[model samples]
Target: MIRFQLEESDREVGRFWIGFLHAFRTIFPGFGQRFLAGIVDHHQQPAPTTIAQLTNELEQKNWELILENSSLISSENWWSGFVEWLQPFKEKHSIVFLEDSGKMMRKAGEELIHGISPKLRIALTASEIWWPRWFSEEFPGENCTELWHKLRVANNIKDFSSEIILPKRNLLTSLQNQLRREDQELLIQQIRSMINWLQDQGEWLEAVRLMQNNKDFEQAGEILQDKVEDWSSSGADPLEVLFWLKELPGVLLTSKPVLCLSAAQAANKLGFNFQVSYFISAAENNLYALQHFSRNDKLWREMVLDESGTTVQGILAQITQIRIGENHETEF
Candidate 1:
């Protein structure tokens, strides 16, 4: 059995455990704690040395993970996985790692967006899509490079911002202070509009859809702040952005980072910021709910495989195998 770790660099919080094995792929090559075998799962009370044990542990940890996620997950829930209610498992395996990775990644993405802006980070994600590293090899390309410049700008902004977060206190202070009154005001407008747009989960979904189109993201975000200020009056929410520095309630709440703040710190090193962070944050924060769409994402893999004109087995092999040259991918 091969012990594969999510090499530290490849683990982006927003993209992390969010969606592991797709629903359609759930049973393949085996799942649950089965990734860890005998040494971890042999006993009546097996230790988590293998995937089966890992699954059992994941189940126990899922609840706790959700509890931890309560910060974003919140204490209340209108609906839980209805399937779990109908039939419970003999051993516990959780969707929590996916949740943790999802939430954490969202947070990371949002934080990155604050500086990098989620738009740019996303471009980078797209640019790297077919790269041997992350893509499962079979994945087709969307060729969204037209917005490459826009995305690159956002990533550059984030890179510069990360530099602001250096060990030197003076640099942080200078950057913090230099983020002038005008910039702060612009931030307020951005947050307000985003919060307004993100009112419900559906609108949020549409926005996310828009993000997938490189043209949409670069245009929407690149011009967003500046455009809003172009029309707004002076003195709307003077203290809004400053409020976020301290993680203030309500005011900063709307100021969601394009990438998630939770996972932001981790991605600070990604040479490029992918903008999927904000949406990631929304799901993790539970500020947005996951609505069931008419089309099941489970079928996404099938559609992808169909495009590749290969059996699922072939596609599976394509996705699981790492691509070369793409950073973070373990070359075989």
Candidate 2:
């Protein structure tokens, strides 16, 4: 019944085993008290070499202890040192242990794959194989793609959920600084596929941001356009609209006017007069810039109209009507 906490920092150092040993001592008093005393050397600590010798002795003793009392450790503590007992209980207990620890320990299941036989390895769920924290600090930068390819082939994996895809997305993300031009381009395609999957779930903005991070500016712009249109059509929050508008890479001159139009429409719907004016002014200023690069007026017009259910042309017409009315009043 001993409670153990896994600190985020504990995962980085080898002292995680020490924490487990301390907790194990609490549950089984007789064994734990003797084990801790031998390891700690009666609080009269020795020199560095002696401490190292003591640690080795502690590990050996722990093995003997785990061998005799496997039930003392819970599945949650499996990665703590209970894995050492797997040799005896592996056949009947392996899968359940793998499933439980795989989800809980974050990275232990992937490491456990190295210790077990191929048959046991194959029994692991896709989730365990592609465990979210599969990428570790010591991972070689360039070989990540090859490593994923090997895992896919070894596991006969044909499809990927977000669990698998997101890790690959992160691997591709990290490789951005280290990969060659050709390799980056190759990863861009994989990144694009995952982004597309995310978009289907209404995660357009996050996907757009990731694409922008990868410097896939063109694709990011395309997705941003779709996002602006989708948000405007759905009557999304004006503040949320502004948040995304600011995230757009300003160098995408062609998308700027279209996004501004959508934002203006969203702001107007929410009765935010200041935001509507800001976006309308932006769209008007960018129209001339859009004209220089874009030849398709029809597509530009549709971007302002179809997506928001009201056209830039319509807004201009309303202004004209007001101006004409004021002119007539002045004449009268």
Candidate 3:
């Protein structure tokens, strides 16, 4: 005989909500008929002779099927029925225990639960590869994600023990392109544009610094690679830091780096983690803002089309104004 209880906080084995559900489901078929007999056999003190008589006495419940599933339950999936805001029995959980019941358990996991209850059932699993490690500490008994990952690999190998397989996405590449193309006018435009872009991207650069200083490689990679816009399409490279790469505000020109340019020039120094979002319209306008104003919507007009008439300072002011106006508008 085994006692049954449902608890939410307790991570104890054979006492979880899932364990109770499984146990109930397992014993329900035989217990249902016994329950019916127990109800029917309600009478004045009947003969309490055999073990079977005690069984019938214990099984009776005259009321309708009040409690349905109760067998071989697990701790997982107990949260399925839990609703916090509206109180059920207690504020924490609706726990009821069964005393002195025979118990049988299913497998350690619900690997085949899908075949049983497919659509209605949601799987209880922690992420293996990408899950945060704190989850394991939160629920120590819930199978180890690390071990589970290894188990999956081991199972895969056992299924095809002799087979040696290569990855589907197997490719090899080498050789780097060695062309140095520099348009002085475009460079000036890029340098100016980046200096202004830095103003809007100060916090982002700070986040980058934090990552670099702390050696947080992943976050650094993300901040440097995330796209600024979704719709624009252009061939681009990572580590293209087009924003806010300016010298200090009050610094002398001689005290600053040798030169400042039109575009982000920090990519070569930084890893391929940062990227510059280039809008063709913005670039075109920056190149031709003062003299020609180019087309209103062309995204990629050569910025320094007429370098003499289109100075970097003017282009920076126009682009900055356009950007400010854009930011002012609610894009939502």
lDDT of 2 by residue, 109-215 (tens): 24323443332222122111232223322132334445445545544233456454322221222222234444544454545555665576566676776565455
What's the TM for model 2? 0.37
Q: Which candidate leads in lDDT?
A: 2
What is the overall TM-score of model 3 with all chains considered together?
Answer: 0.18
Task: Give the TM-score (vs. native) of candidate 1.
Answer: 0.19
What total of clashing residue pairs does each candidate reach?
A: 42, 0, 30
Checking candidate 2 for backbone clashes, the offending pairs are none
Question: Tens-digit lDDT track for model 3 on 1-332?
Answer: 22333322123221232233334445453333222222111111112332244334334422111222232233345333332311333333243434212212112123322232211111111110112233243335555344334434533111122221211100000000111133334433432333234335453554453343333444443344342211012433222232222111112111211112232223222211111122323344434443355453343233342323444444456546545544565374
User: Once superposed on the true structure, which residue ranges of model 2 sit more than 4 Å away at CA?
Assistant: 1-183, 198-206, 251-255, 267-275, 288-312, 315-332
lDDT of 1 by residue, 67-166 (tens): 1221222222311331233135324433232223233334333443345433323323332121221221222253223322333443321222411111
Put the candidates in TM-score order, highest first: 2, 1, 3
Error of 3 at 130 (Å): 1.9
